[model samples]
Target: MKVSFLIDNALREAVVNSCIGILLKAMDIECKLDNYNFFYSPSGFDFFDRTRENIDLTLFPSYNVNRTPEQLSRAIRTNSMMVATHAEQIINSALYKEKLNTSAKSKYSKQITSHFVWGPFFAELLMTHSSIPADKIYITGNPKLQVSTRLNTSTPNLSPSKSVLIVSDFSLGDMDDERWSQFKKRYKANYNTPIHRHYYEARRKLVNWVLTASERYPNIHFKMRIHPGEDRAAYELLKGTNNISLVGDRDFIEDVLDSGLVFSYSSTSLFEVLVMDKQVFNLDLHDLPEERKGEYFELFEWVNKSQFMDILRNYDEGKVFYPSSGRKKLLEKYMYGGNQKAVLRNAIAIKDVLENRIAQYGFSDFLVHYRNLCLSLVKDKAVKAGIWFNKELGLQNYISTLANRRKEADLNNPVRLNPNKIESAYKIASGIVTESEIEILKNNLYEIRKEKDGIYIDF
Candidate 1:
């Protein structure tokens, strides 16, 4: 059997996809990895679909449930099955609840939970929301965990090393600062507890704290790894006096696994570290206000002075703590309260559904459908916006090839100001009216008629 993994980014696809490839290879199945094609080939998304038709199966991994299951199901088409691994709680949280609407909510809640899904706690979700038969859903252990074990076993003589992993948040509106500020104001007024504000304040304190620690412990190295989606400037500003090394885009996960201790305030990467059996110190400095404390703590691990200092001292001694035997224990006791061992255990039980089972639709079929829909929408939006701007600015006439000829005539003869060319360029450049942004060029002709104004622009 042969399989192909289709993903957008290299660093983003490293963990789970790598693990699945290794596992399938060990089973004597040919695993081919497709990467960097998106960068070199503009039509790579199209080429990927053609290639998918020849594969035995293709895995489309996703963490969030932003699109409907039907949308997901129809996107990929081929002779092979499409598999996805989803983490339920992360999607069900209040953060995602706001991003989805009533129809999207019903679709995701209904069909997504039914298919070949893998995550630590999925049983409860499946029991409550899914309508698909139980046998179809497989709980292949998180490939991240399976792959991490190899690192420990491969090198029995590995020595202790000090490393700190930094992760960025999915802060509300890091894309546009103006919109982010507005969100901050509304959140402050209504909820009285802004999540991003707290996260920023904590990050500020932690960066300084890390700098102090790095200075004091010269032997220990510090590594800052920013999230892919985070605003780079915000991260830089947060690093007050910290002159530590930064992790490049591709080195994030490898660094995390190799670290002696992981220090993070609110990143989900901390959970990944915990799964690696490494010591994780969640630096919860200030207490949340009474009313918001309960919900806020769910997103972060509460770290007091005693626990923080103890973990720091322990790291200096070359000792590491796993905290719990498995994720079930760690999550059940300290994180979300439950006997979630069944959920964890079930996740590892089914791994062969993709091998012999028939797919409702193939990978190529889904990819072509999704790719066409997306490209069409993107092109339509771009053209419509360009037309609207062109018309509103009154620059329509300047867009014609004739306008360039008029400019050349004036360029050759410095003594003569060509009214036609001047007017055409002006109309094209000015943002005036939708009917003929071309009209502004006419205004330029008026400027040129005053021949004494000798400043000229070449076409």
Candidate 2:
């Protein structure tokens, strides 16, 4: 048996996928972990679909609930049992349901054979709202959270904690005029409330507040971590300030571990910080009337810029403490992160499907698969020709986000695939998979394989 994984954010998924690959190898099953672009590419061309081409199962991280026909079409083309695990777990309950409602509820949800969830919170959401069967959802704790905890323990001697880490999850209206125009028009047509509009206004207010605060207090060091896809040109003012420094690209845990106080709004990273038992202040940037905040905002004692400064003054006087009880309760409710390692639990679930212990209900039949394959072959020639022409003309920037998903995808995601870092995480072994059996194969591309002495690249 052979299994494959679709790895998007390499920094976070690399270790988890590698560990799963090793576990499957122990079960005498082959595994391949490939980037989304690389996995689907045919002979180094664009818009091709060769996923699970010669493999049994493919674990695609299906982050969004609503998928277009074009999106679902590729899954049909996989020609193998496909499993889905939502990479970005929900933060905003209101927006999450909307994102889940489209074709996912009507088609894509049932098409997937297995759905790995973080816990009951998401499981219930999928079953109730997305038309996914209860049996299909596996409540494995998030692999990212599990790997994050392991990374935290293995390497603790990081830089001294900074005064404050402002983690931004805001996608502002500050992109190139064309993209921003499209974004606004889409939101205006679809949303009931002006969701993006409110976020933009609040974002400017918060940024200005932070800039003002940075100048006011020279002693308190401030660090800003923005999403990887964001245009950095918007943040050029920070270079002039002595106290404020923009964070470099690194794992989310590394930034969190080095920060004394956490401040964020509208990001799932808040859950990650809570899992680490760090006390985080919810930055109240909701400036609109009847604003619907995420479920997480209720957990923190939110404050404005002045209140944030007061808290910092209190922190300097040794009056701050981590919230252990809050962390425990929230983790239980959302993560289902019981004592057992999440990575192992997730691997076992995948292994069960590979061994035929559990059966999947794929939406497509054999005839549908054959038709899709024919369409893809015909489609690829045109895409390949267009790509060749576009590159020659140096018109790469015009490509939409879909094709922009290649290695250099500017999704504002900072974490990247690094073989050495993955080995470090595995060397700190999560029990079932030992350190000796797993090695990251770094020939031309990073592929983690399990063997005593050989790197398996036969696929």
Candidate 3:
């Protein structure tokens, strides 16, 4: 039997699907897993042309099967059982609503035979929110959590460093279409400001706080890890600080393990830090009212700039501020369920599906596996060669030097402001602010236009 796991994102989803592919193979099931970017294309029909007849099942990660008409028709023609497993633990209320609403409206939910979730909390959430049948929801804990637990156990001696790690979210950057729409609707009602401007405003405050803390305590290091979708150029202002550094592409687990304290606005990494027994602080500096503070603040130890600064001072003096004792209970309730052998359980469930003992699903080609293996080997070797070349020529440092030079040149150039240019730039920068605010910003910029070489506007 052949099974294909379709993936989009590589960082976390690819890792989880690869582990599931191994588990399926151990259970004598032929599984082909790889990143498929077809979902991002306009014509979703392209995915059907890439597969063969013997493939019996196709699994997706937290995606509705009938997103497009072509997708629904392809599923019907292939007669393949489709399943979806969430890639991350759901924490954001907007995301939860989006997923459940999409799942409820999906016409191919029956063909998408099962929905594997992280824990009982997610299962209950789905059942309570969506129209998907209760039996189809499976509590197969997240594979990433299982891997993280194992890595943490084996690397227990990895001591923490005296550095503060900032786990950034994609909110500070250009958001996708769906997320943009949700943000507009959600924040417009609460704060009466544009969603992107709100994110930018909050991020500016947090960055300033970090800079102030770095200046106050030159002995401690501060590292800002940019999110995958974030444009590093957006944070060019923070460059060249004495005690601050921007993290480059590196393994997140290793970075987290070595961090003394973790800070985030609202990232899923907060859960991972809790599991690792590390100090975590949420930078909750939004201007929303109390009722609109969101659900994450209820669970995490979110603090304002003053509180965070105090905590930093204490940490610099070799004192740590541990989270309240109820954090572990909250962790168990929301993220993990104390199951370390989730991969084994997932494997057994897939085995039952293949054998027709559980919900009927349906793979059988030896050459397909051989061809995939050969391609993967070639890709792996090519990656290794590129790494070796970069190290031998010190290409990374050279690239960094070039980037810094360009940034310096841009910083030295004074930005001339006009009414039309200001309006255009503000629209591009603060996607979705009111007309009144735009006028206010223009007037403010006019006042400060001649005072400095480069104008810096902070809302």
The candidate 1 region of ten consecutive residues with least summed lDDT is 448-457
Model 1 lDDT at residue 220: 67
Prediction RMSDs, each to the true structure: 22.2, 8.2, 19.7
lDDT of each: 0.45, 0.61, 0.57
Taking all chains together, the TM-score of candidate 1 against the true structure is 0.59
Model 3: lowest-lDDT 10 consecutive positions: 448-457
Instruction: Report clash pairs, candidate 2.
Output: 228-412, 229-411, 229-412
Top candidate when judged by TM-score against the true structure: 2
Model 2, residue 275: C-alpha shift (Å): 1.1
Better of 1 and 3 by TM-score: 3
Q: Per model, how many backbone clashes are there? A: 37, 3, 3
**Residues 1-459 of candidate 1: C-alpha lDDT, one tens digit per residue:** 667665434444444454444434434666654431221111222223444445555555442234333234333433455544443233333333322222244433432322433332443344344433345455333444444444444434232556656555535325354565576443222334455556566666766676666666666667776665455665564344343665545434467665676776555555556655666666775444454333324535567656666666777777766655554354443222132222222222212444346555435435646765576445445444544555577554432223244335423432222344333323321321112212222232112110121111111
Better of 1 and 3 by lDDT: 3
lDDT of 2 by residue, 356-423 (tens): 53333454544444665566666566455556656676555323223445534433445544455456
Q: Tell me the lDDT of model 3 at 39.
A: 19
| lDDT for 124 (candidate 1) | 33
